[model samples]
Target: MTVESPAAAHARGAAVIGPIHAPKASEIFADLLRQKILDGEFPEGQPLPSERSLGEQSRLSRAAVREAIGILKQQGLIVSKPGRNGGSIVTRPTSQELVASLQTYVRSQGWGADNRTLLEMREIIEPWCAAFAASHRTDEDLQRIRQRLDQASASIDRVEEYVSAGLSWHAAVADAGHNVLLSAFMSAASTPFLSAADHGRYDSLKARKSTLKTHKAITAAISDRDPQRAFDLMARHVQGSEAPLLENLATTLENDTAATG
Candidate 1:
């Protein structure tokens, strides 16, 4: 038998190890760029470096750099438009985006929290959101909230319109809370919660009237800048609105109201 050469043996051994690709170069580059964007190295509305520059820094092919940039755009970190004036531009992270993300996350959790549990969680934080709104809201916030409330009040007979107005009012109150985290939470929760409460028809006629009354009371409390009253009104309004859905809880609330009365 012929003896194999040392070089031949080494070559055969290297072939056995395959191509040695750990991960995609584009993925690594994207990760590095993501950190930079999150770290504010690329501020909102600022243009990102050209693909050529990124390619050189990353020691990657132009195609790989493009892939990385595409990942950033997908993440909503950067936007790219084709044209003379368009390239990769960093995005301003909005509360709306945060809320949308939160909504997606909650949905993904599936059984993590049922509607009742989710509503309860909302109830815990929302009263405080109203109280804060009372002390912190600006004239702009007041105007926005009042406009939506007016629309809701006027649309009592119209289901879709009423739902739309109710959503707007919830969003306005969330904005009025003046806390980014709380605003985002409420914004995310508003659609699902109200949609569930309405059960497809938006709101029952009786429910709509009660909702209008309760909302107006809460708005008045906030407008008057009465934090304690705002909190109380909001709590009462939530308990009342959630009653039909959670019959036993509503019954308990009614019993308490009667006992107190």
Candidate 2:
């Protein structure tokens, strides 16, 4: 073979040495695309670039571009269709999807203690919601609250039924605040606490009666449009009942740890 020029030799040597060991182009592309979706640069229902075009634009192989699209699909950020003009399309993230992801992450990390912390947060935030409901409630709102209270009072003979009704009453108060975002947040935050409370000593006769008394007081304050009184009653109701419930949970956990260890 004829001797190669210096530039040709350098090219041969570089080829033998293999391509530069840079980061995976697919990962970089994926990250860039993900950011675009999150920032609303690629809005929901908008079709993404074709795989071949995206590959050329990003200076990556078609395989890299396709892999990035796969990642976005898995993340609930995009959906893919296969046909003529088929491509990935961005989708709006749903609250249920986000909540499921969060619950999975929290459960994987053994976040029971964090659930307790959320209960503490509810004690503060929910009272404010109740106060807001009290101040802003219309006659129609009062009627709804009264209806829930009536259902709860009727179920007082059965602890489980009563507790379920009681939780509904609080949920109604949150809804009556006329703030959908706050209502959604409180609903998510209280889910774990309500489950725990359902199985706790709050199921006892004396506890049921005490809870009914507190609920009545809170309802009365809300009905009378007494925001300060509603706030105070809610605060005391949470502190008095939640502290004992938590103490019960702590004792149970200690016993469980001792047995398991």
Please report, in order, the local distance difference test score of every candidate based on alpha carbons.
0.79, 0.76
Per-residue CA lDDT of candidate 2, range 1-261, in tens?
995566786876743333477777787889999999889899988899888889888888988899888877778889987788667989965656665665565456554423666657667677887898899888888788788888888987776677667777887888778876667666565455455655665767787778788888888888888999999888777766446445767999999999999
Model 2 worst lDDT window (10 residues): 105-114
Q: lDDT for model 1, on a 0 to 1 scale? A: 0.79
Return the top candidate by TM-score.
Answer: 1
What value of lDDT does candidate 2 attain over all alpha carbons?
A: 0.76
Clashes of 2: 0
Clashes of each: 0, 0
Q: After superposition, how far is residue 103 of candidate 2 from its true place, in Å?
A: 4.1
Clash pairs detected, candidate 1: none
Tell me how far the alpha carbon of residue 213 in candidate 2 is from the true structure, in angstroms, after superposition.
2.9
Q: Which ten residues in a row have the lowest lDDT in candidate 1?
A: 194-203
Off by over 4 Å in 2: 1-27, 61-67, 70-76, 79-87, 102-115, 135-147, 178-181, 197-201, 223-226, 241-261
| Residue-wise C-alpha lDDT for candidate 1, range 27-135, written one tens digit per residue | 8888998898889888888899888887887789999999988887777788877899888998866666788898887666562323676668667777898899999
